[model samples]
Target chain A: MNSRISAFLADRLPLKNVENHIKKPLPKHINWLFSLGSMAAFLLILQAVTGAFLAFYYSPSPDHAYDAVNYISKEVLFGGFVRGLHHWGASVLVIVVFLHLLRVVAYASYKPPREMTWVTGVLMLLIVLGFGFTGYLLPWDQKAYWATVVGVKIAGTAPVIGDFVAKVLRGGEEVGAVTLTRFYALHTIWLPWLAFGLIAVHLFFVRYYGSAGTPKNTPEDMRSGKPFYPDQLFEDAVAILILFIVLASMAIFVPVPLEELADPTDASYDPRPEWYFLFLFQLLKYFEGPLEVVGTFVIPTVGFVLLLFLPFLDRKEERTSLLKRPVALTVTCLSVVLIMLLTILGAIAPRLEPVPEQPPAAEQTAPSQETPEKAEEEAVFDFGLD
Target chain B: MTDVPEEGQQRRTFFKIGMAAIGGLIGLAMAIPLVGFAISPAFRKASKKWVDLGIADLLKGSRYKKINYTFSAKDGWVETNKRRSVYVTDQGDGTFQVYSRVCSHLGCLVRWDEGKDQFFCPCHGAVFDSAGNVVAGPPPRPMDKLPVKVEDGILYVKES
Candidate 1:
């Protein structure tokens, strides 16, 4: 009966093309390192599933966002595990994606026909980072609130378009209700759509050009590449299984953190960006005044643009081995080391000390012209409040 | 006969232009409101208000007094208390200095350290003196000072 159903479905559908894609060939030389992309893809799927479950209970408003997240963690069955998977999944995804990029760099896989694939991969990386940035603010905790405040302000340090960038990011002068809605929209809808399109294109390009086999492989080795069905598929599954085990273990063991509710009036709270962004945060401390643009804009922009055009810049066709490619290897090593060092520095950085509490001052007996209710009403009218 | 080909080409060009106009109209129709909706907050002016701190007599002090104030403000769809703190010191000339707690470098709130006699930024190690001048660290300039008024013994600080 199953065979008959499969035959019936296969008659009308493009099942043959799907079969060919599934049974595609990959290089025999490819090892465990080659599974990084698949691992990242697995984690992304895990994130989407976990995030959707969390969203079923999550409220986006500033007033209820924290409470909603708290309810999910404390009350909802298996909710903590889901949230933990999402939290650790994001960090793990970043690492896997970075390692994938490094593997490509090491193998000189971004050359020639794979250039477009590399470009799309880099874009997907940015979108992944965007997911992290936007997702960080959903908890509406002190950490989320302050981190976003500082993060948006960093964009404000840029020259010319800085203020506009900051304003658009915050959705106003400060990180308030508008900002939360904007970030929530980006995290859940807009960014995911963009990422979907990019991922599709990236995968298409990878399929089109086939795997850029190891630098050590000869033409004969490429010609005799193994079928992806059993060998590479098995390897990919193992890598994904390991990743899942680690993710699930962490999810079950480590409960997601929910700090005190966001308090804008609390001046003593020190704001720090997420660990993935700590390198950039630490890098900003080196530049001050007019030179602030270097840290905030120039370095990041120049680095990204360089990465985007790396395939074109290194035009040599004969070189592929890491041992032979001195410049690429050196640049990769330097960037990795510098980023790690900066992240470590940022993690251990001292914060502003708390001020001593003072006695309460006398209260104002007379009412002000702009009463609380009146101020809210006027603001609602001005903002076209929903 | 030669003109027939040119006429055909002209007709094709006309069709192309017509199609382009239709496409552009569709795009504009979708884009106009979408862009406006997304960026409307960029043009939003923060609701400014004069918060009543307290009576002027009680505010007259040698050291800066930390005062917390709450005002109703609209944040997206919710109307809630917009809480903020500021350091105010009587300048002894019947004027008061109201320095914003927000650091000038990034937006991390600065705290007044009684031991150091200066404002210290928690995010970065920025230090500002009693008069709001930048003492050290990465802060570009002095701390921000807000407009202050004393009307009928009530001390009011203008906040945006």
Candidate 2:
């Protein structure tokens, strides 16, 4: 019966291709770190599922946005859980994608035939960040509104096209009802589609070239390893399951913070971007006045362009390991260190004043009222979830 | 006889061009309007109005008062009350001076630092003197000055 069913499907589809993939050879040297790719994929799927659930309850208009989010947390069943997964999942996805890129660099996997893969990987990183920036504004809270204002304004500092980019982003001169809907559409529809297409192209390249294996190993040695199905894939599944457990626990125990509705004219409110953006925020502090474009545009654009064309620039075929490539190793280490330092600095940097404690459920809609002094402090760590 | 082969090639080339032209036209038809619809707001100019800050008596003191006011404006499909604040000082003369709180560096709100007698932008540490001129930090220009006028004892500032 199984054979007959297989034969029936085989006649209708390319079963041979699927079989080949399932039985493909993988390097025996594969370790826990190699599973990071699959872990990221797992998180992406989780985010998509939860994000869809959110869209069901979420009304994109500014009038209902904060209230809709509040309803999701308070009224809907499993709403907080779904939203928490998406919130925490975004942060975790950035870290996982960063580490994956780092791992590839360390292994020199971006060399030669895999150049396009590296390029796509870099593009996906930007897409993930785009997802974060656009999604941050969905809550329509004070931080969401102000951060987007700062973000769009930063985009506007890019010389000639700056004003136009800012206009397009805000959908006008201000971040109002139009901006909210635009970000909602982008966060839910456009970014997801872009991510899906990029992932498809990235995976195509990955499968076509197979695993890059270890820098220490040759093709013959890599081929002598185990078949992927019950070997590497089992490990990948284990890693994904462990990550899912951690994610679900975080979702259950920790409640996502929904701050008060955004007051656009609140001058006292100290606005900070999400943690993933803190580095850029910190970097902007250094470049001011006539040189502001250097921080806002030139450095970032140059860095991204350099990363995209790294494979072509560094064509040392045999210099795979870190020991063989001193310049590459140093640059990678320095870049990572600088980013971490900047993020830490950005966090500890003094604000004009501390953001007032989050108001309770009752006072959420009344924007003009002062937040009560005896507010819950647990919501303080809620800063980094986006 | 040799022209027969060349004639077939010509017909094939013609068909290829014809099909591509049809496809291009169809693609452009949808793409043009779709793109226009998506970015229509960027090209739109937000309407500006003069908002009254209820009587010039509030600006009697030497210190700048951070006055907040809400004006009903049509933002996209919704008519909502947009709140904005400006620092208004008596200028110690017959005329009153008003400065917009938006930092010239980025768009972060600037707070009036009474202790320092200047305006401080918390985002990048930009400072502007009471007169709205850049005093320190990365602000390329002075704090934005608004067009203010008094009519019937009411002070009004132009808001966009």
Best by TM-score: 1
Put down candidate 2 lDDT per residue, B102-135, tens digits, no spaces: 8889889999989889999999989898898899
For model 1, fnat equals 0.00
lDDT of each: 0.83, 0.82
Tens digits of per-residue lDDT for model 1 on A72-103? 67655566777788899999999999999999
| Interface RMSD per candidate | 18.1, 17.6
- Model 2 Cα displacement at B130 (Å)? 79
Model 2 in CAPRI terms: which quality?
incorrect
TM-score of chain A of each: 0.91, 0.90
DockQ, structure candidate 2: 0.01
